[model samples]
Target: MSATTTSPRISPVNPALATPTDLSSEGVAAIADQLRDLLADVFALYVKTKNFHWHMSGPHFRDSHLLLDEHSDQIFAMTDELAERARKIGGTTLRSIGDIARHQRLRDNDKEFVEPRTMLAELASDNQELTRSLRAAHAVCDEHQDVATTSLIENWIDETERRTWFLSEIAGPR
Candidate 1:
């Protein structure tokens, strides 16, 4: 009954973690926020594309599956670049699948059976939306003089548009 107990000390949260970056803290923050959203959307699309790829069937199964796999790989490749860009600019990025779900603006298709044409159409629409968002984010980068991010976004926009075109062609006359 005479033993003394000591409590562990907890450190206070650091405000510096939220401080502005060399590129103007406010601007970096705004751009980072947009990038975070973009990353989430891309991740969601990647997952959806992969889902279609895995479940694809029908006369065009081989081609559709291959195309989705390629698209998913392309979308996945951007996730690292996006997260790193945010961190490089001293901005926080996604940490988990839950984080991506929270930030994603794209709709997910969980249906057991989606027609190949429908999958192509849905993915095309999503890529179009992503392109629009990328353009808007590019504007933010321009406003903040974030040339590095702007340059990257420009390439991504082109890539996304190309993906959209491919999807549109696959979808065919609808």
Candidate 2:
């Protein structure tokens, strides 16, 4: 006599597939794609900020390190909100670091040593770029009539602008 063997069947599901969202598939896709890019850039910036924070050295190291840590935390906090916003709209978001690398447009600095001034300047430039990207994404949200997303983007833009201002002040002529 032989024992019978059986296996449970599993179905594959595609999260990227368009679902029944209140927003149109076309609109959700467009906005979510923009949000994905935004998320990637924010994540990259967060990592870069943390890198500078950890490696900081100079007369102003104490202040700069603390500031970078605070900014990095703020940048990281945005990631969850961004990913959730995409999913709430029935859109797929970054799944892994690879996905972030693929979507991110921000450049990473891997130098063994970056001057404090240079770090501040670089972060300021990055924050400015992020603000511009946020504005573009806000436009997409407006075009798509995604009020919730638009509202969220508005808050992000404000936060980013504040970050840029802080960076600019810290990096000002010295």
Candidate 3:
């Protein structure tokens, strides 16, 4: 008997994320690639929210602080959801800061601090990116015939959009 192991980096290396239906090697590979990207996007958003929560300052100090705290928590929760979903799909999450740094489309919060409006704008932008990514994930799931994941991602996209709308509204009529 011979045993050969898969490349862990190729994803879904754990049973928790078994493909909804057994997929072709090529389908698995493609789905895994998208899952990796989505994981990176989520991690980046989580980190960005945390960063803004810590460094934001200005007139809305108390309110902004509280909101950021809640927002960061939401992002963190999304991170867990993403990782578990990746596993459910037989894809491993790319969950390092380095991975996020490399794959994130959003800009880093490089400054030591930012004004309330800056924080709001940054947060909204990241949410928009996340929404777009989730929508794309829905499309991928549909393509893969994975209605379960598609439904999950559709909810995520809507939630992100609601959050983005709130943040954008607070930032004022622009």
The residue-by-residue lDDT of candidate 2 on 110-146, one tens digit each, is 9999988989989999999999898888878887799
What is the per-residue lDDT of model 1 for residues 61-106, given as tens digits with 9 covering 90 to 100? 9999999999999999999999889878777778899988988989
- TM-scores for candidates 1 onward, in order: 0.88, 0.88, 0.82
Q: How much lDDT does each candidate structure score?
A: 0.85, 0.84, 0.69
Candidate 3: tens digits of C-alpha lDDT, residues 112-132: 767778778778878998787
Better of 1 and 3 by lDDT: 1
Lowest lDDT 10-residue stretch of candidate 1: 1-10
- CA lDDT for candidate 1: 0.85
Q: What is the C-alpha RMSD of each candidate to the true structure, in Å?
A: 10.9, 11.2, 6.4
> Which candidate leads the pack in lDDT?
1
Model 2 stretches astray by more than 4 angstroms: 1-19
